[model samples]
Target: MSPFQPWAHGLNEIRFQGGAEGFSREALSELLENVPLAIAVTLGPQQIFAFANRLFRSAMGMADEDLIGRTVSDVMGDRYTPEIRALRQRVFETGEPQELKDASLMLTPGTTTYWDIKLLPVRGGEDQISGILALAANVTERVRARSEADLQAREAALHNERLALAVEATELGLWEWNARTGEIFWSERQKEIFGLPKNEPATYEFWLSAIHPEDRERVVGGVGALSDPRSGGGLHAEHRVVHRNGDVRWIVSRGRMLYEVVDGELRPSRLLGTIIDITDRRRDEEVRQLLVQELNHRVKNLFAMTSGMVALTARTAETPKQMAAALRGRIEALARAHELIRPAITGSEPSDGETSVAGIVEAILAPHVNQGSPSQMTFEGPSLRIGPKAATILTLVLHELATNASKYGALSVPDGHLRITWIKGAMLTLLWQEEKGPTISGPPKAEGFGSQLARRSVTDQLGGAIAYDWRPEGLQVRIDLPLSQLNA
Candidate 1:
């Protein structure tokens, strides 16, 4: 009762009776017509179609008259290439069956379809091959689906390759954990990050031990949060690690926990992420904080000193112009001292953050010293280290003396000259003498702000004493300070 039941009888068992009721040509044709495949028969050397089934006619988009007596080229047009002809000829001459998979055909002018084609040789009663039988199945959909999947797979591979290059360029360490297998994978860079041996396997216990003792507890808590659903399965932490050799490093880790559905329930399956070394950045941050604190303390001291200078200058100046000129000169001197100190405080100094007494004296007086004349100033001293605080106060005291000399003392005339000398022992002794300038009668009646500030700084701040002798030609000043105060 099946459409193909006639085929159940072997070819040798079939006896042609020349009637529709027996196994005859008409009966065979009827059986081929209802089969699912596209079946056709071609005859003789011209390969003219001798028979065509319903599916064959539909697949070719032709009627019986258009195909029955026509050669393959007449019906297929340009679509029947020499390759197809050679395949059919091979089947006819060798009397062997041939198969072609995923062959393309043009059933319509502009449309294409693919097929799996099988061709068989057919013989006449004379026992010689006379025709070809073609069986085909449409496979366009399957072939296109396979092609699309291949394209997507290639694109995904390219994407992963680019991502790996980016990670390597940035020196990022990659890691992965498989919860079900109790195994972990570490990239070569990841091993470098933890200072692990090349051949040593990465383990959870080793990871925990590598963390600094002070940070291990916090890191463990962060891991716990990674697995907790409430935390959205993500983690970010900055911590320290201690190597086997006792070298400590800072690191920042960022990762996420992956989940999979098992029996319709989501469960943690792996942890994956990257870690990068942050030791340099951490050190920079610490240095920046120290600089900020140092700058703040210095600013407060400067403001307090300015307030005192203003209050004291007001009492000594006979006019507002005098006060303004004195305040400006004092502040400018302070600014110049700040410039010398900043290089050390900001870590840009060529040597250690320490300055000697000779260095400070030269730096403060360099602007006032005339470049064209060598006789204007002279200095003699041994190198004595001055602390940062003492350097600030000493520079201010020397600047006040120089400002007075430039305005009214030895430095006011071209012929005037100044000499400085210092010696270091249990105490430091320094002398400032000026000569060949405007003659002075005696000491001033009232102590000016500059003189007051210099005296207070020497006696109160620097643990020293200052005395001035207003000689006829110019002035002389001598200062003595304990060695403890000079280098403190």
Candidate 2:
């Protein structure tokens, strides 16, 4: 017989008129023992077991096959049998049926089993309660599977929560792209990366515009190539982007194509990626490059300066002592000028550690100023920052001018004076006026090294204009520099 056969087998033992399926009493009892469901018939108030199925004997963990007259407490232990007996007694008293679904049963110590239980009260010839029939269906596996599924769902939720928190802490900007529709979604952090204002709409053109000019075309083409299925369905790139305020930054982008079966065919629909700010790293790389360029230029300049000093000393020195002193002074001048070249600080705030333009001017002129009147050459200017590149060239130009003045110009006389003034607007303008000193007969016809250095400092280093006017009173110099190059 099937394990779940609905009909009870050979149930002809009970007395009834016109019983259709008559069989020997012993034969009926044997068939009842072989039935599928856990069934039992109990007799008397104690609910003694009058008959028990093989399944019921196994559930009770009883060794004896014949359980015809034993009390339930005798076979199933007193700890649990009392509750079963109480349930039977209630059914008998009320003449009602009982049913319990998904109820816990402890058939063995430290082990739990679930059951769907049913009980029906039976009566004697006097219509008084005499016996009871009970049935139980096992539901342990079903209940266990449901509990396991609930635990897995809770764990999955917790894992996603932790992943989101980590992404937030690291300031990773998230974005989702609809490949076929050309639609895009940018998270708040992603908008910040793009330098977009609040509530600004995002579009593919906007993304392209944010990329650096030199890198934009390549990036756009690569994105198109990503749509090809043979391209491994992923994108990884490092490129540059210009912020809305004109700041340049490096971007590391990664994304993958998403697909789902539609009509049993895989088709791409979405792309997702994350971004982070990498401007600082890009600046560090540029600083390393600038260092190499500066070293090469300075070394070449040192050789030229040494050769010029030798040539100039030969013309002015008459004795061994005079030549040595003159050469030493010239070399000292170069050494002092070198102090003005600050370390290269590249990137947006390149003037961060550099000194002010006025500060550099004062340092170069300190040796030429009269000790009693340190203000012999007065200086005036508003706050202005100068980068190392501009400061180096300006230092050389000012040192040359001061040296010339100390020998034949303003500082040569006790009453001589020079005034230096500058202003900052769209551009920087600096004027050097010499007065109360020897008159300039004429401007130099031939440009020498000092003149060449001064001119180059203005045009090459400062990216500005320089002019000289030799007046009857004294020589006047005016310099105009781009305000941006001063790192203001």
Candidate 3:
């Protein structure tokens, strides 16, 4: 073979033995010089570059003389590290061939590239190396793609870490409930919220059993409301739960109801939510409520006492003008108290100027009692909403009872108490009992102005019946009103 014979087709023979079968030595040289991949053949020991193809010379910005007979370090300059230089020559000295995938190169200034490289020994047919064959395929695109994918994976992992930190900072326990299966997946914090062991199975029944009995029904109802479109697929409630260790904790749960349509009907499928321990907040609210109640009681007692004083002031007038002045003062004061009781209904015309039965009762009787007077006057009943007309009629009936109590019944003594209870379902039923008051002899033989007004209010306006049971201890009045008419 000529020293300047370019290069042989033996490169194809070494790795892929018969790959160059039909090609002559001159034909192989012509093929490699124009091939897309960079190829170089170098002489032994010194590993001097002997044959440089067009693609390889173009990449190095050199002609044949610049690359041919030049070592890898000579053409590639100092761009490659000493370790890589040693690796290239180590194959030559040891007659060993090496295959490298995704090898990096910086032979040209300010440019980087990658390649799939194969370094193989060329022998003289005696199993002795005569030269080295170096072949490489451009792999920069594949390497860039793999690098981008790795970067995206790392970014996603970082984002999840940040989200977890935010959730922990908010002290929120996340949970997901599978409605159909009754299985629940709880986050680490949620398991802590439920006082479950770090890794215990969380079933729907486990959550239900933790609720305080008193709150279970209301909580369940709140959750059930999620099925109603009016609820906007949202569930929210404040309830008490008993931990496994018997500690009662108050929590506020807020969540969204997930649904899927099946068989033409909407069905609940999942619920995702957060639970927050609100025991401290609820306790503070209760304390504030108690304080407000105390203030309300004192204000009521003061107003009632002032009304009584006004009546006494009326008796002490010296002249007609003086009597008129005193009477006008009392009237003005009573008007002010009325203003205080109703407070002008701050929002939205008071349900079209209507109010609930409880609202009416509270307004009329709030001026008469303090905390000590509950036994003297108290209320017991589920809440009921009533229109303004019924509230007015009921208000008048209650006023009459209170007036008689002040004059000759329960309100007359410190210990005498008035208890008002009502039940509303099919009909509205109310019971007014005056106990420990001055003994009532019997129902009055003739109805007074107040008594007649109460009768008319109940029967005509409220569509109800009113009867009195004059017991030995006190008076018990029973009133039952038709609900359909009142609601209408």
Candidate 4:
């Protein structure tokens, strides 16, 4: 027989008769003792315990003490507030059922439990309510599980919010696509990256169209591979985009595809990614590459010029000492010119810390200008930013001219003045004139190595023209150079 069989039989008999009045107290007590629920009966306004089953006594922490005639508050302690007493009184007077769901119950000082409680009014033979019957079921585990889930949801929300703030601070553009709905979502920065207006709706077609024609095929193929299960890792692509404003910019994109099983086959369900503008970095890289090539070309030219100078000096010198002196002077002149070009080529700053035409001229003539009063040499022109290659060629040409004037022209004698001036328009025109210097009978019959090199640099390398006029008082040289070549 089941352990509850005897109690079940008596309880069934009392319930069959529809009331507890006819049953013996011993029979009723035995029936309630073996029941699963926490059951109790309280009488009068003080809610004095008339009967408490084994489960009820255990829940109230009064299993070893007498519970009969004890008030509900006196047994359950302070956690049972006045509101509970009022609720019991109302239930008894109205002869109605009342309930509390997931209510906290503290049976000990430091321990708490939850329960769902129902209070039904028990009546006497006259049908007048005499007591309240309480039934309780523990719900502590269920309430704790729900509270834990709520906490996790809040933490996840906070984490996502922080991640979004970090992404915005870094200026990254975010995008998401849903394959099932064919819908796309773009953050504001994403739209700005593509140069799209706020009102414009972003679509997959528009994205593909924005990519430069040369890179569209490759980018599309990479993105398409995200759907293939065989392909591992996320999508990473660096390509060029033609903005709505017709400006081409470089961008890098990284993303992963989300997949779900459909009909036993894994298929892509969503795509999410971020984009970063890399136009400035790409341009800097290109400039560095151009600088390397220009440096190599300039080194080769320097060697060729040095070889020619050696051969020419050997022919003219009557002695080895004279040849060495000429070659040393020429090499020193080249070194002075290179001092101006070094900053630009090596990515350092010159003394004046400038990379313009005026900066270059001021640096090269600093030595000569310090020797005489400022009035002896004057410069007049607007400053233009020139690249390393332009600065190198211009430095060599100017250095050669200055050396020639110091040796044989205006700078050779005191009281001789040299003025340099330039004007910019369709092209750059410069004048190097000397006054009050040794009279010039005529131009040299044969072109020297310095003159040949200077002419070649101005015309061939700089795509400019040079002319020398042997005036009676002094020599005047005119040079006209293209603006494009100078900037390059």
Candidate 5:
């Protein structure tokens, strides 16, 4: 055949292969060039860009002429790392099609792009490898969505961990039971709470065996009712349990039935719940109730004793003035003591039993201040709040000191200052220092109600010691009480 004939046959074959029916070589070239899809032609060994279509140039934001002669490295710069370059080289050497799905690429600063990259190996006449034909589809939005989903999953896991920690701190336990399989799963904390062996098999039998014998039947019945399909999945109960070591405990169990598909039909498959121990709380409530009963009984007894004292004082009073004064003083003292004993009867914690020291002082000093004489009284300390017994006894002692001060010492004069300063040490020390009053003498002529009550309160109720000194300055009384007693 002639050379012209061979060239004509070759052109015809190229036209047929290019899918350009009844078209010449020039027409086939024009059609291929104008096609919308991106296409590129590269040469062997160097993989230099030989040609590029309009779409390929537009996708990369470049002119076709600029991209045609430039290699991938020249056009993409450092965007193509050594690893990716090696992948392309492997594709060229193997002549195999390589596809990377959801691949990430950074095309601009602070902007990320994703792509599905396909590296198709092109072949020459003898089916020898020429170069790789790389095609990429932007998939940035889909990749971003997947990333957000993964972030949400991680946040959910962290939240769950925090919630579990909170539950553990509060001594709560959780469990789940598969109704279909009759299998129970207990959290490690739940096992510890129920006093079960860590290696114990989690099952209905194991759970029932651990329950207090008296509560086991009730717990089982409640759970059975909740798991029943006819009951519509409502079950909750609180009961008592006896642990392995014979310790009685209170447990509150709550769960609901969850349905799932098995084979074909829907059926109850699980009971998920939590258990909490309420033993200490229950005992505290019982104690509070008992204390309330005891308090009522004590109040009645106190009233009877006070009534008898008032009757006796009335009979002994020689005149109306003495009768009124005695009645008022005795009533006030009784009120002060009653206030001190209130907390002890109510079973409140020692800290909660604190009363205002200033109030106690005022109550005790009221009767003595009634003598129609100007007396200066001042209290100083590191703002102290003390328990019931301490307040009562301290008040009584201060009253006795004020009576003495008013009768003959500092409180008897308008200019006299009765400074009662209390310093808190390992024990509480109260100093009643009198200044500028009547001249000092010896001890009192006799022990009166104020003195006797003061001594009794200090020694008995407060479990403390008191000393009276006739100092040249004034009559100074020193009181020392243990912190525990004063606080309690």
Candidate 6:
């Protein structure tokens, strides 16, 4: 027989005609002792605990003899709050059963338990409810299981939200395809990655149509291989796509397959992947590689030009001092021009066709301006900017002038000074004037490479006119060039 058989038999016996007038005290005692559920009886507003079964006494860590006829507040102390007393009182007044699931019960400061409680009113012969009878079953394990499940669900949702935020912030598109069902799920970013309008139905056909004709077969083959059960760990592929507007883009897809068993056969079920747009990044890398190759070629060409200049200068010099001086001046001018063009050649801002005249002048004159005695040089100009070619030519012209002053003109004398100035007019006028220098009588008996190159650079290369005046105390040179040509 079950442990509750005695209680059930007693109640059934009392219901039958000609049965015992009331419960047998001995049988009632035996029934309470054998029942596994805890039982308690309380009476009146004071909540006097009239009776408690063995299970109830044991659960409360007390003896039945000591608990009998004691007030609930006196037995349970602060643990029996007013709210719980009110709930018990309502059950006694209504003469109905009040069930509570997973009610928490505190037995000690550190020990607690959960219960499934049923409170039923016990009535007297007059039909007036006189006491409350409570049946409580321990439900701690079930409550703990439910609480853990709720926490797991919350943690899973938080993880998914974090993954979604990461994908959106990186502008990556996610996709999942159920191979067996032929169903595809695409993230919102996937549509945007393909440059497609949102809210448009994204079907397999729509995506396949966007793939470039040349790449469609390859993409399909890669996907098939990745999803094949016989094939391995994962799959990765890069392909091109043609947008609706006919713009081409590069895309990289990476994914892994999940498998399931059906009919005793392991079959591929889904493919989960991410798609990244790499068109811009790929183009930038290609451009950088090309620029590196171009820079190497330019450096080799510059070396060859320097070698040729050295040979020409060596053959024309009549003495060691003359050759040394010529080499120094020519190399200095070349170095200055190189400094002006280096940034442009490397694809930095103010590149070829976009450099400024004022910027060029400042870059070239920076070295001289830092000297302790910089009174030897002065420059004045209007606000102006010119293209790389014009800037380069102007840098060379100024270099030649400065080199001449340092070697044989105004700057060669301790008290001498050189004034370089420019003005904007119908055309641009630039002047290089020297003061406090040895008197300039005329040209050298034979023109040197510097003078010849200076004249050619201004007149032929720059398409500008030049005038040289040999004065008793100093020299003055003037140049005029079209502003439009210089800016271009």
Against the true structure, candidate 1 reaches a TM-score of 0.64
Q: Per the 3 Å backbone cut-off, how many clashing residue pairs does candidate 5 have?
A: 0
Q: Write the per-residue lDDT of candidate 3 for residues 358-432, one digit (tens) a residue.
A: 666666676567675344678888877764345545766776677667768988898898888999878899999
**Total clashes in model 3, counting residue pairs 3 or more apart in sequence or in different chains:** 2
1-488 per-residue lDDT for model 2 (tens digits) = 12233323222335543356655556666786777667888877887888877878788877555576887777666445455666777887886777666677788888898776778766776666787777777778877887898899889899988978987898888889997788999988888888987599888889989999999888888777766666666888789889888988788888887776678876777889888888788887776776667767776877887887688667756987877865675566566545545434323333334477787778778777666654678899987877666776777777777777776788788778888889987888888888888888888777656677789878976789889888878778988989778752
- RMSD in Å for all candidates: 9.0, 6.7, 14.9, 6.2, 12.2, 8.4
Model 1 Cα displacement at 243 (Å)?
Answer: 4.3
lDDT of each: 0.83, 0.75, 0.73, 0.80, 0.71, 0.75
| Structural similarity to truth (TM-score) of each candidate | 0.64, 0.66, 0.51, 0.78, 0.51, 0.62
Model 2 clash pairs?
none
What's the distance in Å from true for residue 445, model 2? 5.2
Cα-based RMSD of candidate 6: 8.4
What global local distance difference test value does model 5 have?
A: 0.71
Model 4 regions lying over 4 Å from their true place: 1-41, 51-58, 61-65, 82-102, 108-110, 116-137, 165-171, 197-199, 258-260, 314-326, 355-359, 362-376, 379-386, 422-429, 481-487
Residue 155, candidate 6: C-alpha displacement in angstroms: 3.0
CA lDDT for candidate 2? 0.75
Cα displacement (Å) at residue 446, model 3: 37
Q: Check candidate 6 and list the clashing pairs.
A: 356-386, 357-386
Best candidate according to TM-score: 4
After superposition, which runs of candidate 3 have C-alpha atoms over 4 Å from their true positions? 1-22, 27-37, 52-58, 61-66, 99-103, 107-109, 178-183, 212-235, 256-271, 299-488
What tens digits encode model 5's per-residue C-alpha lDDT throughout 1-488?
11111111211134334353566655655775776445666667787887666656665667877887678888878677776687788888886666666766667667777776666676666667776666566677778898999999999999999998998898778898888778888888788778887898676666777777777788788777764577888668788866778887887877789987767766788888888888888899887887677567557845764676567667767988877776676666666756665766565554434565655666666655536655477777876777655665676577557656775788777788887777888888888888888778777676655566678768887788888888777888888998888654
Per-residue C-alpha lDDT of model 1 across residues 1-488, encoded as one tens digit per residue: 11122122222344657765576777878898988888888998899999889988998788988898999889888878787888999988898777777889888878888887878777776668888888887888888998999999999999989988999898899999887787999989888989998799999999999999999999999887765556788879899999999999999999999988889877778999999999999999997887788789889979988998899878878899998988888888898778756665666763434587787778777878777676588888987777655677778878988988888888889989989899987778889999998999999998877788778878887889899999998899998887888644
Off by over 4 Å in 6: 1-36, 44-54, 62-67, 93-101, 161-171, 212-214, 246-249, 263-265, 300-337, 346-354, 357-488
